[model samples]
Target: MFTYEISPVFILMEEVVLRKMHSIIGWPEEDGDGIFCPGNNTMSNLYSVLLARFHLFPAVKTHGMSVIPRLALFTSEHSHYSIKKSAAVLGIGSENVIVIRRDERGKMISSELNSSIVAGLVPFYVSATAGTTVCGTFDPLNEIVDICEHHGLWIQNDAQWAALLLRTNQEVIHYHNRLQRAMCCSQGLLQECNQLCAEYLFQPDKHYDVSYDTGDKRIQCGRHIDVFKLAFEAQINHCLENAEYLYYKLKRTDFKLVFKGKVNKVNFFCCVFSNPATQREDVDFLIDEIACLACEL
Candidate 1:
């Protein structure tokens, strides 16, 4: 049987980075209490850490109160398997997960959610998937946020594949309109780099300054490089744009746009062609040809 290992140093580093980021982002609301450390990266570890934190504070141990051991973790059936998995990991019983039913088109059934919340199962947290994998449908975020607030539940927005909300103009207009259009993408990337530096820049209670002494809170020390190298030719590669153009061209024939956005990705429906008149191999060859030609340019 495989067992979880405890690494004091590694856990300390991870917690420090998480806390520092929380401070920088002003999230999870730092209350001056010491943070709990769980020495693993699996979904189980996440659940365990959260439960362990609740243990330290008995105020959250009641039914209607803050220390409720009972957690009604909410997510749609279309959401990732991790939701139910995390519940099981925390020993809350998978039945406690409370999977919200979806509509005919697969968006979460809001009425069912409303009924359930009114019944008072006492929800603790919700994980909303910004992009459902099988069909890629985004749930109504504003509506969901309102529901969560009414029930006093925390929300974790999952955006692994659908975090491109940074590209919209109406949203960015609140900060700066024409100027943001000029440098938003570049500025966003640079900001990510700067935030990382702030976390790992050899300061106490941060990453780079932890010593490797006996019983010290670190597994490894000395210089180690973690760098991501992108190809110099990445800019010249217009494969994504070419593919998108081809997608739009095909859509002009008979496809119906279902969900339209550049963030979570655009979804469309195309009727099945009766005759297999279009050569699949030829289409592949044409796309390859277009990519090669664009690269050469």
Candidate 2:
């Protein structure tokens, strides 16, 4: 029988570079925490801040959102519904969670966001996507951060698609793993990653001095530690590095802009459209032509 290792929710440790990375990213370096959730995926991470915010009043745990005034939250219309789910579960109600508009490429329209913020509602939090679901798009983090900072709003970036970097060469050069060989994420994603780390700094280990333990910086409470931590990081890096090549290759094709933007450093782009001038009738003819060509073979 294949034994299942039932590890705890999280391995209680923080990356040694967690704090230093935070400082460089421009986070406060004082008020942040990372956790590793055993079964926790994106929603758990989203729900965490809801719990923390309620804890701010300390009575909300017992009283719920009823104790506070009508608070509001914000997320992109194209974002994963987890934002709304978090709001509903937190007792904030889905209606109060404002869904911001996105531009043609699925990126959040920052100007529309700014307009919404001043629409007389007490907006407290704004959750942005690092890579959106449908188009694999990215929100404008720099613009979002500026708005959030100016409005005293808490900003959460859902980077489940691009959670952290994986310096493969330096970290996992000696390790061997199937998945680890995938992404060594390259340059394009650096901007998004840096902004997230800086704006949402995660530095909550008392030791805080310097240790390579990065387990604590995630949102999952009971985290499971990867024995080959550096190796795992390297693997992700490797994966992204390879993925960038595909982006380049695909961009070389004359595909239509299904999701227009620079090659995403995180998720793969799904280019599903052809040139605007291409006719549907031509597509049908091409399909038949391909069928005939296959038969000829």
Candidate 3:
């Protein structure tokens, strides 16, 4: 019923509220009758990665009459909490999920990840975050991908916040290994991709009748259509430029630089207002001032 354009910025740091579907959803690459929900692209990326991992492990395949596949996922301790949440929602035992250790920058240490896999954990899925909320940091995507490849694991890169991968100056040659599926909410890029790769990349299932009959991949049913529109609008409006403006302005101001990333999104270190011992009115005043300034623009 819907499709998402995948991105690779090296990405969820959002809560998604799902509404009821009016009908059975169909294949996203193709189309049919179904209720559609605007899924969070980040969540979709996470889910797809897990699904891809399922297809990688032959031993984890569905048994004779069962369709459920046992999956084990790996993520860093500093990674987003959604990884665990997704595992729980997907019926995978939370205990089966392994939290890989990370370095000082919160990037999962390659040795640990490899060790876990070599130790026969054989996690079918490994996720690396591009940007974290507490601190905007990128995990080593290429290296992790290599490790996954060596061990027959599928890797998913969360590029939700690092939407800047669309910038003209961005370089993604380092991340092009079997990354056939990705997710983005940028409309302009999706349209551009459709124009460039539409003919060769996407095709409707000729045997939709057979595949659609069983309603397989019901997990893939709720794809979102508006993600592209949102991304397009953000880029068209120079959203990243405006973010840069605020970032530079705040950095030059009395505030400190806590954590910073690309122009598309940035955060500042405001120890003064964030201190719990600080007076509430003072924090409120600062917040109000920022809000007023934002409204003026």
Candidate 4:
């Protein structure tokens, strides 16, 4: 129901690079971004990396690597350069940022990582990509997290693009509820996706206290709850309720969706509304028709 356009750099960072954060219901900074970081951009979220490292070794603040031993950072080859950039800025030269090999599907090869660890590298941190760039594949977080925990390595999850998938799910679930209320006069097409509907997302749904979601208790500063919170949260939940709407909508229509409904999570939905009989005039007419229909309501 709402959209925001920040900047080319920030938007591109969110689309292709970084991710996460938020909490606290108190007085947040107003009128300026000075209040809180959306963490929707690369640079904004990268601050967490610096914070984690600094917290691990407080001396790194006043003294530059004088007290700490030789340290390295490991991340997947498919990961964004944001980690390396943070390293470079934090006095850990880019050379210390090791790139682990990834499999054909763009997932980090855990075996290769084991070999790297065996090769005598003292890693201070290991970043895992929950969702990757380019191929939109996800690295094996279970393996990566296990490795990092065993080695006392700080883990960072770049889950920016994954957040968008939450939106697609939200839209479908919301629309379907409206249809069930019989509010959609011409929405019989909504049922076309009943097969695609999913009762659960990747994990089985269980009734648990939601407070446990952010119980990590990391040194994260509270963010001003963005105005988009409630609606977007509803949209995120929509993923669970109406997972089939978009897939079935395009399947039953003349429009062809890129990727043909095959995506780990629907990130970039490139739709080609190509039709041999459609004319340039039809585009404007369709917009007019939609406007008139909206007015009819």
Query: How much lDDT does each candidate structure score?
Result: 0.43, 0.51, 0.48, 0.48
Clashes of 2: 33
Candidate 3 per-residue lDDT over residues 1-297, each given as its tens digit: 222223111001010101111011112322222111144344554444444544553333343213444556788887777777777765666776889987765678888987787454336878787765555577888888889888777677665455334322242434533221234222122232222223332344433322222112334433334324323433433544544445566666655454333432445442211122344455446656976887799
TM-score of each: 0.47, 0.58, 0.56, 0.49
Task: Candidate 3: list runs displaced more than 4 Å.
Answer: 2-37, 57-71, 167-173, 178-224, 230-237, 259-297
Q: What are the per-residue Cα lDDT tens digits for candidate 1 across 87-109?
A: 67555667987888876556777
Ranking by TM-score: 2, 3, 4, 1
Could you tell me how far off, in angstroms, the CA of residue 199 lies in candidate 4 after the best superposition? Answer: 52
Clashes of each: 8, 33, 12, 4
Flag the better candidate by lDDT, 2 or 3: 2
Poorest lDDT segment (10 consecutive residues) of candidate 4? 175-184
Candidate achieving the largest TM-score = 2
Model 3, residue 271: distance off in Å is 14
Flag regions of model 1 displaced more than 4 Å.
1-68, 118-120, 164-246, 249-297
